[model samples]
Target: MSTQPPRLPPPAPEDAAARNMRLLVLLRWLAVGGQLATILIVHYGLDIRLPIAPMIVVLAALVMLNVMTWLGHPHWPVTNFQLFGTLACDVVALSVQLYLSGGASNPFVSLYLLQVVMGAVLLHAWSSWALVGLTSLALGLVAWLSPPLALPPWFATTLSPVYVIGLWCNFVLAAVLLVLFVTRIAANLRSRDAHLAAMRQRAAEEDHIVRMGLLASGAAHELGTPLSSISVLLGDWKGEAAIRADPRLAAEVDEMQAEVMRCKTIVSGILFAAGEVTGEAPERTTLRRFLGGIVAAWPGQVTFEDRLGEDRGIVADRALAQALTNLFDNAAEAGASAILLTAKLEETMLVLTVADDGSGFPAAVLAALGRPYNTSKDRRGAGLGLFLATNVLRTLGGTVQARNRPEGGAETILRLPLVSLALEGSR
Candidate 1:
């Protein structure tokens, strides 16, 4: 039998574009606020005779554009072309405002650089350069066509104290915005990279599990013949007249047969886990009965509690049963005198918890839980129980959590969607 991990799909470009579009919308709102404050200060505070009506019209148009973009954002995927168009609109709006104020002579004309920087960060090469060309053209048109601003005699020239102070303010605003927006964009990129890295790690772990399963399946196949031969020999000895006459001999033969049968059952489980057809159909049973069987079969001092109100029908999943057994084995190895198992249904999920009155997990083992070979045992190939259990639950769209109780001992919790094991047509 062979198996492979499910491949993870790469993130779509539209995802990043959509996120950047949101940033642009936020920046646009900031632009509106800044533009309004600047317009009011220049026209009223500075006593500058400016084209207030037309500039206000431009501001209103920007506000309406932002509103439309916000409303349509969820309905459509944002694309590179759309982002380019948004930047272009801002460029035109800024050009008109600059033209109304003082054309290229306006101190805030440097704001064009902010848009160019944003484009380079958020756009593709072609779009970034296109924005550059568009901004350059707008700058030239404003310089050539805009009417001169009627400034006070003291502030008439570009070298006036008030004009130099305006340039200083423009520099400050540009610097602040660049820092804010660029840092946020970088954070978005970093988050995407981290998510991709995690996906890669999970793929690698699943591949390792596949290889291990193949090896185990091959070993089980090789052991099957010898185990069957031994079983036949044990049966023959049990039937012998001498052994039947001797109670001690008969008891010994019976014990050997039982052990051999247990070994065969374990091999069958291995084959089943490898995705091989076991020549037997899965047993259909209710959740309550399934849990009861596992508890009754466990050869240990254990308690079982089922708080799952109404019973639901499900297929008997041998792999899941084996995973639970692995947890029980671990508890036994930890010197647990008694183990407690609890089951409950939380909406569509089945929640199971196993707790042991043994020494809690070591800090290092707890920290690296679910990782192969991460165990406190000094024996070779130890610590695979929890690793395999974790992977099995994960394959069924479930998760396992391990923690030490404050009072004492350790607890492991398993949660899986009941739909994964639900019988067909059984709610």
Candidate 2:
């Protein structure tokens, strides 16, 4: 479906260096085999008198070039040196072969095109053009200066056309290989840049996690006293006889107490997670119940919807409830009154998405959303909320990705592997 050539695998630093070595060794053997077979077939079947000894010595030079190709990557200085050396050898070999086989009249003279093509494949554009010029001049010199050998009567008059054809082949092959290598180099640069960006994104996420933990721990400590006082006041108010007489007051008090308890529970959970201060905590919980609590606890008025597919779920530190609460709060602040949460299941894996019809991502927080220092909220948030969530998901062999929708709003998708699901349920 693509017009471009199939790319070689990404050459990341590592075993790739050794792989280059092995490849050069293999290429040397292949080139040697092809040359040896050609020489044997031409000598015996066609009786072409070539400079066999000089050709054998040139083959030795090719072997040395192979060793250097193994040591030098595409951009190394030694790579160009080997490329030039190989081109020189190719020209010398072609000249020697021409002198023996009747100069331009030789049946095999057209094959010199391969040398120029090989040079272009491995060299930069400027170097490739220089090599092409050298090739053409070499062939012309051989045709004019070399003494003509006595050939069979059938091929006597075709000498001029033969040399012209050889020159044309050399130039055409050079053009083709130049295009090939240039395209390969461009693709390599793009892939390397993408890999670098991913690494930087990860490092920023880690720094965010540490800062978020400290902030959550501090927030829990500060809220402890007020939550305790409210709990006692509500109990005393419930005991008053006037409150029992008024059903309306009793109901309102019950709702207020429920909300206050919810806030206390959320604060306590954050401390237990970030501060490691809980007595008993579950390692994992069912996705449905976990998410339902998150939506119910959000501080803003919003319609929340969910659709869990068959076998759809996730395994996390049960701390996922707090993580989702953080995300929901962000959506609420973005003026999203409605949000949708859904999960997809296919072949033992889960993909959960949280979507909101609010401004996709604030321009201010875009650059540092998952990082440790840039909080979307105007307050000093320390920006670790999403960072913590991503880590929790990663520990369970999952990932989190966020993207702004082309139409409007934003979505966060979490991909989870299910290999350890049964193991998680036990916790």
Ten contiguous residues with the weakest lDDT in model 1:
167-176
- Write candidate 1's Cα lDDT for 1-427 as tens digits: 8899999998655577888988899999999999999999989999988888999999999999999998998789888899999999999999999989987578788888888788878876677768777876776677668778889997785545465456545544554465457656766888999999989989988999999999999999999999999999999998899999999999999989888998898899899889898797878999999988888777777799889999989998888898998899999999999899999999999999999989989999989989999999999989998898899999999999999989889999999999999998874
Q: Write down the TM-score of every candidate.
A: 0.64, 0.51
RMSD of each: 15.2, 13.9
Error of 1 at 338 (Å): 0.7
Across 137-222, the per-residue lDDT of candidate 2 in tens digits comes to 77677677767764446634655666566665655565556546654775687689999999887776666666767886887888
Q: List the residue pairs that clash in candidate 1.
A: none
Model 2 regions more than 4 Å off: 1-201, 242-252, 275-277, 283-285, 299-316, 362-369, 372-377, 382-388, 420-427
Which residue runs of candidate 1 sit more than 4 Å off their true CA positions? 1-158
Kindly provide the TM-score of model 1 when superposed on the true structure, using C-alpha atoms: 0.64
lDDT of each: 0.87, 0.66
How many steric clashes between backbone atoms does each model show? 0, 1
